[model samples]
Target: MKDVSGLLERTAQSQGAQPRCPLTGTLMTRGLTVPMDWRRPVTSRERQIWWNADHSFGQIHPRPALDEIPEFYDFPTYYTHDDPNSLDSAEEERRIGALGRLLGSIAYRFERGAEPTVEWWGSVIPRGARNGLEIGCGNGDRMKTFGAHVEATVGIEPDQRAAAVAREKGLEVHAGTAEDLPPAIRARKYDAIVFSHVLEHTMDPILALQNARDLLTDTGILSVEVPNNASTGSRWMGERWRWLDTPRHLNFFTPDSLRACAQSAGLTVRAVLFRGYVRQFMPDWILDEARITAAQQRRAVTQADIDRQVRHSARLLAATAMAAPEKKYDSVRLICTR
Candidate 1:
């Protein structure tokens, strides 16, 4: 494998150059061309899904079933169990909750190590503006960190259980999506609106951005962080890319595509920065590829397979860390103004 750190630095240096769109073969000036026929329907016995191989976009079947929202907290297969109406036994729920916490802790440790402050808003956050909002504030840890810099912080979460957890931590969390902000929240303007790893899950990202724009003050900033589809990790992993968690992540955005999307929604991009998440991606890729290969062979994933990938991933993580610079990143964070 190429040194992850060296690859990242090379990628960063070429950020200004335009790359050809994989689908259209056109030199992408702003965004890649998304063909109407690019969607390939994926059929399963239970449900239908679609994937745009060219643009890296995934969509769930049963098309416009608006009320179907999956319960994100339900355990071992956190997001894999996609039945929106499925319920678990009390014991199962407890196990699932514990697993969720454990995974969240691991992710938090990695993220905090990558960005100690966890506030990548840059100069977009104006001085003396102490109010902020976070969309899809899962578990509220990031919101807690934001609280350190702001006097007042609130969050909009669609998951009822997750919202309750955030409320328990004394956060002013509303149990809903950003599309319809409660009247009280809508009445107040904010210095910043954060969509940390949330926009990709939204059904309509552009509309979500427009709605978020409405709640912002004239000088308020919108800080978005999403997995970069144009990253070296995506190029290397192809179909096994960790970020392509389908039925959940609806849209994949590269920096250029995201900037164009933001501009289309009437937000002006100010700055774009990347954050390295090789630790997360490399291990996930190993695990997912193993699971996929096992499924293809009509067999269950074994402990031995899991252990082997885990061991290999550990080595890759160590190498990546050693090669990576203190400031190099994998995820793209964009700061925009309305």
Candidate 2:
């Protein structure tokens, strides 16, 4: 683990030339750059710059690399959101639900892996939606919910704990990395490949999405949801960006970069929507930022903390209504057809 972390540090030091925009194939630059800080007030200048700019506003180019392709092969050590002792089981459940809702706030009609609602997808899926694959079906709950709708549904989960949870939910899950997709999943191609917040964690987005395309039947749609690097939440939090889970999250994406990745992978993006909204907990993020900077303040992500996050998020909802909408505040969704 130390070696992996060391390698990651070295990778972070190596910055490549600025990336090119997929839309115009031109170089992209940040219009508004905010230095890393906790209490810095969110600026209107930053928001407008993000809105009108062709490229993302504050994304740190050339993300750090990992020792292995499956970035999560070794879970991250930072304890921002994973604390067993912080709260009792009941409180933990509440936090998980809150986080889920925070994530759910995003406007995605098709619950990434939850496929039992074929009628939901059937309505959108032009008739003859044959086969589909879900790369990281966490807990399989979503797959179990929506698996029945798809002609065939298969899930890949590298974590043993998550895989067990998925199996318990009556899902056909494989405990392995997408880099080593099960033979069965690879053999069968589908009309669509769904990746929900899974691509950002991969070491190589191009290879991962290309693998997805290989498994798709011609003209298949690749549905993905990733943290918007261009989002206000991201700019508010730089290196300590909650979504930029060092070592765990190896790749970051914005509407532009995502399009770049998809085009490089030979896929055409049909639509990109940034509707997910979460006002976010300012104090908690401040605390987390302090912890990251000062080792003494660092602690595991606990249930009690999550509880507060839920309550804070609720307040944020009302606040968003009263104030400007952080349209680029939450995770973004992209629907692409190969």
Candidate 3:
């Protein structure tokens, strides 16, 4: 591990002094040097990830100052800016293949108990919530999902371009970080506030949580979901894990760290749930790995590709069920009340 330690020391010197954990002020360690992922290369900024001593949390060292973060969000390819309305419905349906949709519909009947990503998110908003806010609500997707339950849905997006798209959808979006809220948002109390994978992007998650708590009414729900740093994915893949999309993802949280961070923000942790291993996550890994293994990889979808995908995905399903159950999955979701 001498090489690793030397790398961390060199990284520290280049970045100018080590960075402490944003939430706890603990010294960070386990410096992992990684290249930007093939899919989400937000910036060319060289970064090293450092985990807190307890291994419960990790973050990019030399964390970009709040204002400097915009440079990393190279807008066009950045997914948060995807305006749903701009998508052509014909092309969208084509993307979701006809045969796949037919099979999925049939399977969906048998899998009625399965929670859709949107429904799972909507479940956390307190019953009778009149107004709800989604921090970092990109294109207002989840906001639209929860709008049925709540009378009104609002969003806070740091990227002005993304916020403009959400606003075009008639969503009341504030283009600012939760750590520093606009007066309009600070003036009102919400019945529910959702982070939904947004907290990790903030400069100070604890401060963001506190601000969210303060924005809540007497009875409110605060829902948060972040990549589980201690998940089977992270444990198995280490620095190679897909979720460690650093520079974009500043904070890495495990279940315990998330709970502690939430409590530190002065919110009551009602329940914590771990989900999204086999269903939401593993398929991509399975398909990608399978593609690399097969000699006859094809650019165009074919019956052979379908058969291969199904076979590989089934094996992973069985493996995940046996090996990484519940709390060991990819995401950590929490429901908090105030």
Please report the candidate that would top lDDT against the real structure.
3
lDDT of 3 at 85: 38
How well does candidate 3 match the true structure in TM-score terms? Answer: 0.75
TM-score of each: 0.65, 0.62, 0.75
Which lDDT tens digits does candidate 3 get at residues 79-110?
Answer: 67773433355553344355433433333333
lDDT of 1 by residue, 1-338 (tens): 11123323433432334433323344433322221111111221222233344444333332323354453233433432233423344432343344322432343345533342535334356777778999898778778776666669999887766676678889898876655556666768888888988887775566678778877788888888887776555554444445655545556777766776688678889877667554453334455655643543456667566555555445444444433322224567778888
Off by over 4 Å in 2: 1-85, 88-120, 279-327
Give candidate 3 misplaced runs (Cα > 4 Å): 1-16, 37-43, 83-123, 279-318, 323-328
Candidate number that wins on lDDT, 1 or 3? 3
User: Candidate 2 clashing pairs?
Assistant: 83-301, 106-276, 114-142, 115-146, 116-145, 116-146, 116-147, 190-217
Q: List, residue by residue over 1-338, the lDDT tens digit for candidate 2.
A: 00122434434543445544323445656443323222222211111011114534223345433333343343423232132444454543444574535443542321232222557555444456667678877666555544555677788876666677667767788865555576777778777667877887664566677777777776667777777776555664455555654444545667777777777777778876554443243334423543433321234445455555455445444444333322334566667777
lDDT of model 2 at position 145? 45
Superposed Cα deviation of residue 70, candidate 2 (Å) = 7.1
Q: Which 10-residue window in model 2 sums to the lowest lDDT?
A: 43-52
